[model samples]
Target: MKILVVDDDIHILELVSIHLRQAGYTVVKAMNGLEALKVVDREWPDLAVVDVMMPGMDGYTLTKKLREDTEIPVLLLTAKGEMEDKERGFLAGSDDYLVKPFEPKELLFRIHAILRRYDKAVDRMIQVGPLLINRQSYEVVLGKKSLLLPLKEFELLSVLASRHSQVFTREVLVERVWGFDYEGDEQTLSVHIKRLRDKLEKLTNQVKIVTVRGVGYKLEVSE
Candidate 1:
């Protein structure tokens, strides 16, 4: 997987890029928000690690821009340990937050945690007939064929499948799939749900993620 590291401090950027590369991921470096944006447009990384403070544009602004176009996971690095700073990061669409003066292991752990959450979101693939989900690999197999899913779509499916018959409100899905402390609009969950439904249609004609109208949604085995 490809990771982008955006920071004004060259030393910090180098340190993070080196460690990410060592962990078997391709690393892309950006010095400021503008540079990060350009890199994102060109490379389309699997994930991004951004520093809060910068000269050209701040991490918050960059994160907002990225969210408008993509659902790539973002991990914010903030020097300020204030609650306000952390809240601001979430409000701007970051998936996770890490305070500065952090150990490399902690950074690695956060990245792994985010990836693991993405994986867990699809921990089970319910087969109600022709549908098949390989929860371990996040692969959806449909009658001897497989479909490729984006990260958010995969996460959304996982969340619904894990609960099976249980209904989940949009608020719960946003918190569970995004993060417990996420502050983005609830509509983001709708977008992901729509995408998942569209993809699942290719496998089966049934509605796997059922809308519960006044309640929320449930993944039911089609009758």
Candidate 2:
């Protein structure tokens, strides 16, 4: 897999690149967000390790721009270990966050975890019932008809559909869809669920996602 390591610190960039290369990945190095964008435009990497602080464009802006174009997984590296910083990273579209002074093994583990999650998402798309999510095309289909979905809505549906019939608490949904450090209110999940239900209602009268009342929610496949 090809991976991009973006950091203003040359030493840090080289360190990460060396370890990632050792782990059998093609490593691409970028010193700043502008360079990162240029590199991404030329070559699409499977994953990116972006440092939060940079000279020209910051990592948050880079991550947001990248997310707007593609769903390629991004792991943000931050020097600040504050919870708010982590939350901001997630809000900006980081798939994972790692604090500075992290172990190389931990970085490798996180990369593997993100890749595993992405693979599961791909597998789930094939069996999302009447709903078809084409990641490559960024298109959603309900049966033979196409349905338009906002980015967040698509992400929410992807997570729930992946574990059809399994109960996912509001917290779990927030973490999985919104990211672990998301500071948003629990009502956000409810609002998204309602919107998703409305859209899917057009396809099938029966609700695929069921409310678990006091617990959370679950997706039910109709027979």
Candidate 3:
């Protein structure tokens, strides 16, 4: 899963990212709320780890802005441990809240809990043309065949299928699928797209990931 970590402290950001990456999560970092918004505009991470204190925008406003458009999970990780602060975070749409000096294990546990709950409540099955993606099952069916795909590839396809015909820039695609802080270049996305294309070609030729030249790519359904 992809997680966006927002904090003014570089040490905190790095510490959090390290632990999250070690736990097999793609980590995206933002120094403050402004950068967080830019990252969110393109990335749409599965969850956000935001600190309450910052220079430009505080965590409360950031959470509020995020809740305005997306239902993506938000977890407030801050130094404020007061009951009032926790209540404010909840009111701001934070799904979970953890104070500073927290154990990394506890953080991980909370993340898993939130994700599990969200997955259960959400309808993750998506139908795009002849392809059917069961995210909860981590499987995809094309025509009559059930195909197995690597995690990243499956997620990439899921994102593309989620917004059929909408062109996604390489940057946007990487942010959404691989996380905004992905270390690989655009070549990585190309490789995955190629692999997806090869597998998809075996299924049929009606649906395609169309390249839009200067723009990026779009899922083209020939009907």
Candidate 4:
């Protein structure tokens, strides 16, 4: 997962980035809220760690702006420990808050907890007919058999299974499975869908990935 860390303090920015990287996350840093917003447009991080106090565009404003268009989770960091400050942070749409001078381990724990909560809320486990897609474990199981798929293919399946029988445009699928900045063409999507169909055919015919002619694709689950 990717994390964006915004802090006016150079030392705090580097410290947080180093710890997040050590915890196996891609880290992007910004010195202020304006820079953080720019980085977010370019990076599309899964979460953001923002310092509450800044010269301009304070963390509260930044968090509110982020929540306006995207659901990216925010964790506020501040030196203030008062309840009012924390309440303001929450009202700004922060998923969690951490006081400064915090232990690195505690930061890591909170990040993990926030991510888990998001995962649970965003399709942690999806069941479509006889197929099971476990987002938490990244596993796809059909009855007693497990289907091993490449990461992209698995992500594609997960996206489709998240909303069974829902039509997803090729553009939308590409953006979700591959990043918005993906350079590949729709052929990449076609190939993956073909592979997924072949795999499913070998196992069971209960589920099918059907192309909606001029529209897109949908996962059809039969009873």
Tens-digit lDDT string for candidate 2 (1-223): 7789999999999999999988988788899999998888555577999999997799999999999976679999988999999999999999999999999999999999998888787653435665677654556776677877888888887767756776777766776678656897888889999999888887775437789998787777775
Between candidates 2 and 3, which one is better according to lDDT?
A: 3
Alpha-carbon runs more than 4 Å astray in model 4:
124-151, 157-223
Q: How many pairs of residues in model 1 come into backbone collision?
A: 2
Q: Which pairs of residues collide in model 2?
A: none
At residue 102, what lDDT does model 2 achieve? 98
Error of 2 at 65 (Å): 0.5
Model 4 TM: 0.63
lDDT of 4 by residue, 126-184 (tens): 88899888876777788799887889988998878766777888877887899766897
For residues 1-223, write the lDDT of model 3, one tens digit per residue. Answer: 8899999999999999999999999888999999998887666678999999998899999999999867778999888899999999999999999999899999999999999999898778888887788997778887678988999988888878877787788887888787657797779989999898888788768778888898777788886
* Alpha-carbon lDDT of model 2: 0.83
Q: Can you tell me which runs of candidate 1 are displaced by over 4 Å?
A: 122-223
- The top-ranked prediction according to TM-score is 3
Question: How much lDDT does each candidate structure score?
Answer: 0.81, 0.83, 0.88, 0.89
lDDT of 1 by residue, 1-223 (tens): 6789999999999999999988877788999999888887655576899998998789998999989877678999988989999999999999999998999999999998987786566335465456666766778887678887887787777767654776777766775678656788878888888888877877777647789997678887665
* lDDT leader: 4
Candidate 2, residue 32: how far the Cα is off, in Å: 0.8
Better of 1 and 3 by lDDT: 3
Better of 1 and 2 by lDDT: 2
> In model 3, what lDDT does residue 49 have?
94
Colliding residue pairs in candidate 4: none
